[model samples]
Target chain A: MKASDGQLIGYEKEGSELWLWDDLPELHMEAGYRIDRLLHYERSPYQEISVAETAAFGRMLVLDGVPQVTEKDGYIYNEMITHLAMVTHPHPRHVAMIGGGDCGPAREAAKYTEVERIDVVEIDARVSEVCRLWLNRDPSERADSLTHLHHADGAKWIRKPPVPIDVLLIDRSDPYGPSAALYTKAFYKSVYDSLSADGITVFQSGSPFFDMKGLRITTQRLRSLFPVVRTYWTAIPSFPGGMWSFTLASKGTDPLLGCMDRLPTDTRYVNKAIIPAAFELPNFIQSALD
Target chain B: MKASDGQLIGYEKEGSELWLWDDLPELHMEAGYRIDRLLHYERSPYQEISVAETAAFGRMLVLDGVPQVTEKDGYIYNEMITHLAMVTHPHPRHVAMIGGGDCGPAREAAKYTEVERIDVVEIDARVSEVCRLWLNRDPSERADSLTHLHHADGAKWIRKPPVPIDVLLIDRSDPYGPSAALYTKAFYKSVYDSLSADGITVFQSGSPFFDMKGLRITTQRLRSLFPVVRTYWTAIPSFPGGMWSFTLASKGTDPLLGCMDRLPTDTRYVNKAIIPAAFELPNFIQSALD
Candidate 1:
């Protein structure tokens, strides 16, 4: 494609060649990746799911045309989303993950031996099936004996959780379509009721640059529902903005004092020093939260 | 553009409509922004420079098709690249910036009342001329009394002493073309020689995701020269990968012990809490540094 100056600016997708493009329409920006091979494609009751292999990020899972996770950088998101709350709670025994059909968060939670049961409520069972086949290549890597996969609506399931969740992780997509209800105050109140006294819940808050309003609203909602609320960020290249934020709402436990030293050494993103560091917001972001 | 499945993927550059496209060819990924109006375009002795106004980012300055600064988000990069080192140094009076032709680093340095002199050595006089007109809209905002703009090759200029630089900032583009020599060990040694006994120098390393090798090598080269070298990062949505890294090398002071409490209150991105927070590297990045 040629720019206005007739300068050869960008490459054009050739006919019959597969390429995945993600658009941040609100920000007037877009990112494109070349797909080497299409591994899986299906239209579930919820959203369109596709798995493609690319040289840059290996196998990538896309939901509703949005790149969800990739073999290369998925660990960063999974670890950041799970480990913070997991380590924060003194003794996280019962864990629950909502809408994480890909099982990436479940995989990270399973690393802790003390966790007896993990209930993953995903509305679409097809995502779990496809990801198991392509993304999660090693079934043995996950603790099958402890993890319970329930293909139920997370919003409904969270209203009456089977167990009191010590570390509740909401891994839903953007607040749109079926996931819109999951981001509401009512759903957050349900999450608050379903957790233990010292329980902590962490969920993706959206990109700070593109969705600061969403982030601010999420923080405000979480603050109203929980005693302690903290917003942290992590970098995931596949995400619309490489920097993605997450809000941790707890009944009692302080996220900044999380037992990061106990963080599994296998993690690629979260470490002891980075846990508190993530909570430190830049001046602009802090102003938004204020 | 259409995907292989006949899906409309991305917007096509229309006739006479300007769009800036930045390609990270090595990563097989690209990001594009819609330009509203073209303000200036020039081919100086160094490289291609263009300034345009965009709806999302307002006015943007592009050097060789790469977006350097935008009216909206330029503060993040300027504050991050400048404040970390500026705050780290105990009493930064004389500062030298190499290749920050846009006068951003100098403007940031001028924020400090103690900073008596700031010498900006830029190779392209056209960059300063264009940015002075478009990006740096307020000339009086800059402490012109304490600032000096020199149009010269930074590599050659740094070889000779230009007063004892308490804080040296290299705000050049990526390590290619005319900026290649600035990344060499010899130039870094020249920088080391020109600093005060307790001087601090910080420069943009690269994007951690797209340029890990480059970041690693830069950190290594700086470690070879300075007694204290620390790597930190900040997020800039317009920049490729959104997350950008910087390396700080000091003669005596520790970056983590920077006087962050004295950070300018008017700044947008940098704050006391974020100073130490920025120094915290994720496990994956720490592994790269190790």
Candidate 2:
């Protein structure tokens, strides 16, 4: 597919056969690794990567084509999404994750043995099947923690949550296609209603740099619905904008308040010292909200 | 350049020419703009961007490009790098960003007017010169906050910092080469010494995902030096690994503490509701420390 003009900017080849579009800009890769849809393309830091995978989840993103939840950098998203709410609740016995088919967040949630039952609400059943086949090769891992996997619309599912859930995670896709509706204030209000009084909800807001507008909109929407609503950003290199943001809202204690004292041991990232530091915001973001 | 036999693979480009090389396969984008170096390049994101200023600062590092700061998505990096430290320190008298010559962080940092002063400590004066001329045009908008511009070494300068700095942002290049010295425990200690008793420090650590080994080493190093040290990750589309991490340390209260109570009414991205949410860590990160 060519960009702008009728530029044939995409191509494919099989073994010795090569096919090139007339207008597709020259790709930096070799003649191998079949070119699929470009998830996100841009300049800066040697060109970022956040494209979908034709092989998995129908079209799951392949940011840099490397695994975001590998043994290396997985902690940032996995821990914050799961633990922030999991530990915040006075007693989070039964938990559920909405649209976390990757198992990255689910894998992180399972660490809390206190979470006796974990449910994953995924839109695409294929993603879970693929993850079970490829991503999570060990059945002993998330398999033990995951009590149920429901193939259903996350938004619709949360509106009338079946069972009593203490913590709910909205680890869905970007706020664009199927995931766009999830960003609305109504969906979050439903999420708030679905949770127990002491429950907490966390979800990945878009990048603040490029999606500051989206971040603000979502944060505001969530704020109107939840009593305790907050927005924080993190940095992951595989997204378009170098900076990323997340929103956490709870009807319980401030996640930041007394968090340092209660921090768990064996953490590679969060600690007592850095607890208060994560809440700080840079100028641009501060200006955006103010 | 060309890849050696069995060395691994990494690639980047300039103009119409594409280059490839071999290494361990680590791609890190530091300070949101420059590619520090290519550790490995077997498979890379070179074909992602329109080539032009490939070797602007240094070589288009095809591999081991130093995993500088990873966010789950880009929002956290922008938000944390901007808000986490900026909001905590009450009325940052002056702010100096070292190595963030690209202006993305600087632009983000400028949102705080309490930061009466901002100085960008850049090593390659050429980088700033070019960015000002090409990339970041509104120098008057944000760069004007920069009270000073120093081409000297950020490490050396931090040892004897200027202006009772309330916040010293080490937004430097990757943790290698000239910047490599910046990531040392000793360097962070200097940063610790440079800030006011209540001052805070936030800088990109590295990709805790792919650089878990590096994150462990750096976290261990930084933790020992500072009374409070925490590592958090964000995601960026440009980086190889999706999950990126940052370390925030402070001499006063925990960095994640506080709300946007003092924020000017004009601010856009930060507020009380969003404050505590930033401290939330994904589960994988929590497990890493374990």
Candidate 3:
């Protein structure tokens, strides 16, 4: 079936075997995954959410026809996104997440004993509830005490954060439809104001291979508001373009000079050796940013 | 349609539009590319070869229904496979490439004035012919003088090299079928014997995310054969799993201590900063290797 955006978005069912077809019409590419079973499906107030048991990736969380995270490889994305900012800050007592409804980032941030509080502002509450029941099944993995779940618009929540945050992680969806406001200058200004003097804001920029223009614009906008801006990348197999980028904008601290020794040793992806190495962008990416 | 292996391997035609589907049944994933036109198709003595004009990736080369190289992002794979070994050796005068029929690696190696000779031994001559005619069309981009294309079996040719090579690059397909012999200890022994005293050999060692066991075995075999063995990775979007790993085995020279000042300045993906950075494996990959 064709989606409202004229892209193919449906499962090609063959008896009990199912294949989820994710078509990226803009990039003229498509990825298909074999589904073992459908766990849950719902149309939240904000978007469509679904959960499925995949043959290779175990359980997967799909948001509006896009695969967001999977059980097997979720550690790579969650650890990369959360730990990069967590270790970069000298003392990140309070952390605020913009739109990580899956609680993957919250779980990772909670691993750091230095973190005292984690405020997650997600517009869709169903996403959090569903993912918790399906993806995050381990009781020991839950960050219950330090995490405060707020079902409010991230843009509005950031305008007046309850406390100054040392690390602001923008974990929203793509910059489109309802999420477009989060990519604007006004939203970025609010993020800047909600942070401490030595705060750092890290967000997932689009794919370096497919979304060079979007990455360039995001970096430029962040550079306009922050003193130090850097871009790094990691590979997420579930993403359309396996290569994904993240941008870091800091007010005063240099990310490269971060305390690498403070990095959590239990992470699956990030390590003390890779913290500085991640910042070394390839020639094409650096040339694009320049 | 399904291939003989029961894997889906055909282009889904929608009116005039076609999407070439490359299915990795083992990984339970499929990737599709929109084809502008089919340029060529043939059955070689070794495998099936086809060329297509793709909407997102320009010209694409597919071997046995597997996407090998695309003109747009081919530079990343070619440069990474060529330069990492080229710059590591102090003075590499002669290089031997095992199975790069597309001539991408040869073109990259030819950029250096120091590289006097290149010997490319490919089992199938038709692959070289088709790629040269369709994928590599530029006359100036051709490495005509330095590269010697030998239409012969690479595993056999490496056993008795014409001369002592300073760098040996194994650019073959996955370790299967006709190429399976290239991954054995006998083949690696020949490669070690064919190089100079301080020679370095680099080969693509499968995807880290999809083929961890293969990577671990390959690293183990290389470590047994060479004094220094290291595995590094770069992102290739067209490849399944996106993240690709390459293993380097050197006789005496350490890859990390190589002369970074000698890296070619005109390459698109590799640069001085990324040369060392690429070697820093994430914790998961490191743990797997350990």
> Which is better, 1 or 2, measured by DockQ?
1
Q: Which ten residues in a row have the lowest lDDT in candidate 2 chain A?
A: A22-31
Of the pair 1 and 3, which is ahead by DockQ?
3
For model 3, how big is the CA root-mean-square deviation?
3.1
| DockQ, 0 to 1 scale, candidate 2 | 0.15
Model 1: how far residue A150 lies from native, Å: 1.2
- The candidate that wins on TM-score is 3
Write model 1 residue lDDT over B1-290, tens digit each, in one string. 12123222222355655456676677877777776777777778877777878766889887777777888888888888898888889999999899878887788888888988899898889988988888877564556778788898899998885698999998978788778889888998999999999999998998887789999999999999988999999788777767789999999899888887667888888888888888889887999899
How high is each candidate's TM-score?
Answer: 0.93, 0.55, 0.95
Query: What is the full ranking by DockQ, best candidate first?
Result: 3, 1, 2
lDDT of 3 by residue, A90-134 (tens): 899998898878888888888888888999988889988998899
Model 2 DockQ class: incorrect
Ordered from best to worst TM-score, the candidate numbers read 3, 1, 2
Model 3: CA > 4 A from native: A1-9, A138-142, B1-9, B137-142
Model 3, span B1-290: residue lDDT tens: 22223333466675667778888889888888998887887778878788888998999998887888998889899988989888889898898899878888898888777888889988899998998899886443337788899999899998888889899999978888668888888887888888888889998898998889999988998888899999999889888878889999999888899998888788889999898999999887999999
Instruction: Provide the lowest-lDDT 10-residue window in model 1 chain A.
Output: A1-10
Clashing pairs for model 3 are: none
DockQ, Cα level, model 3: 0.79
